[model samples]
Target: MTSPADLIINWDVARSTASRLVPPGPSLSPAAAAREVADVRQAAAEAVGYVHTITGLSAAEGLGEDQRDVLVVDRPGWSAANTESFRKLLRPALDAVAEKKPQLVSEGSSAQVFGSAAAGAELGGILAFLSANVLGQFDPFHSSEHAPGGRLMLVAPNIVEIAKQLNVDRSDFRLWVCLHEQTHRVQFAAAPWLRDHLMSSISTLSSSTLGRADGLPQRIVEAVKSLRQEMGQQKVSDQHDAAAGVPARNRLLEVLQTPEDREIMSHLTAVMSLLEGHANVVMDAVDDSIVPTVKTIRRRFEQRGKNRSPLEKIVRKLLQLDVKAAQYRDGQKFVGHIVETIGMERFNTIWDSPEHLPSEEELHNPDTWIERMGYTPKG
Candidate 1:
């Protein structure tokens, strides 16, 4: 008795209802971000094997066709049509890699490998969005290896969004972003174990949360509200500083969540730094001929990010604790200091494994990392 149009209407209503419960992002407190991040990671980890079997592009394709698992994702910055083009290009590249690298195939959907050969292979997957953000810059790469079976994932930014954000032509944005994406691909390919280490670390935290998170988000949101009020129209930067009036903020958060959760958060932050840091490095290495816009692109974009946020705050309030644009400025400074002192090559070691990734101590105190490496923080 139900018409297709009626079905469509029902679906729309359902989706709207569902979204009401979900945060719109950018405004999410660290707690909410962690919750979503964990859910996504869990789904991907669970589906890895099944996706591989379906795709026929397993790590052992060179020796024999592998029916291993694959990672499933929604394309980050693409249309259905654009997605087809990316798949056409990427599938062949991955197929070729599979032909050569039998060691990286997915074992089962859970990132569980059947054998050791496939265990340490470079793992890559894509998640896409169709918004106005730069491709590689907006895209997030979680780890260099997949655990249970080592794997890595890099979500590409929507071409549409990246071009829009960069305020140049889409082609120009792609030209610059491609370096970061390729850099990620190359590093993960070279060190497959890196992906595994990161994935396992993430899983440990995520699974633990799911086990004990029955009333979590509800509880965490309340604490986040208190923290936000303490932040009280203060710029975002003020809240993150230790000297900020916010009390037991971090510690209060941990009381509700598990250490594994904190570790995952730290690991992911390190992953983002590893990625953004390298993109800066490699773009610097390449001749300007490859992309004339490379030099001024990052700075121009950062300025836009800062200046644009008050408007963006309207959007942020829908999902996250409202923080002023200053938080990102602090984040950039943090990232810049790492790049200045470690040199891109060494700053990148964070991507190599969980062990190498900077700790909370390191994020707050780069001096510790510098001391350990016998390198002082660069001015």
Candidate 2:
């Protein structure tokens, strides 16, 4: 008997609950904290200049001249910031849903109160798991209309903990992290339309979800059943060769009942893969003299991904981190293939406009993208 309004999540409560559940770890000594902050700031600047040089984009081009600010925060701070961002992003869709059905909440009904509390708890649990593992994030909405650029957020405690766990040289690892994140900044700066394009796509998806909310529960159940069947088939295929498991598909996208939902998700996945892949390539392309431990760091990082604990792996799967990791690998390979075949100058067309962006299928087969882009591979 719960109304749809009752399901509108109380994200503020969720943010607070998540922060409490995943509180920051042991505090760094004052000197260590200060040193870390300084190093990150320096790295951020260096990375921006380095990426600009490598990408060959200047301010006169679409690249914005504004500088990106860096903020170092603990886990709790990060959780709070991201919760607010999610709230902003989701509010329009929620409001649209309400407009379509005015009677979702009856006057004097307590269902809304109870539903909000329950939704908050669910969201809190998910965020609690994610906050621990996220090292850094680039938030496009961090700035106001007057300020057109974004900010780079470094989760100080998590970064420090990860470095300690991996036993990597502290400076090298921190710089490496900054390099990847900064590449993202350069991407947005170079392609000012990208932020709007992503936001538009996400809004479209959210609106679609809202329009289909009435059947959402049933759709989700059906999707789960379909997924289980697919997994069974995958297991049978795996039995032939344990090392060659089924290829990783975007399982989340596969679960959507509507073709529209699946299409939006595919576009989003392709865009994300391109961005992450481009960042990975740039980070690795840094001269060895710049990062003496670059090879060791890369090896250890890949090992960390492969050796996650069962609990951690479940959490990752829930948050779609597994999908993100797959995107990184797939994207990196796609970028490498295209660059090697057509050369970087031709490959750079992908950034020229939305039309130049590859489709999800094209991401798996660079040759298709190459042909589509009217580029012939070198002999």
Lowest lDDT block of 10, candidate 2? 239-248
Candidate 2 TM-score to native: 0.87
TM-score of each: 0.48, 0.87
- Displacement of residue 308 (Cα, Å) in model 1 is 4.7
TM-score of candidate 1 versus the correct structure, residues matched by position: 0.48
| Candidate number with greatest TM-score | 2
Q: What is the lDDT of residue 59 in candidate 2?
A: 32
Best by lDDT: 2
**139 Cα displacement, candidate 2 (Å):** 1.1
Kindly list the per-residue Cα lDDT of model 2 for residues 1-379, writing each as its tens digit: 6334335777768887898899566578999888887777676666666676666656323232334356777788888888777776776676677678654444345766666677787888777777888788888766665445667788777778888889999888888888888788777776778888888888888978876888878877887787666667765453232233333334534576378877888899899999999899888788767778988888898898888899888777667676788889899999989988988778887888999999999999989999998899887
Question: Candidate 1 lDDT (Cα, whole model)?
Answer: 0.43
Model 2: number of clashes?
A: 0
| Alpha-carbon lDDT, every model | 0.43, 0.76
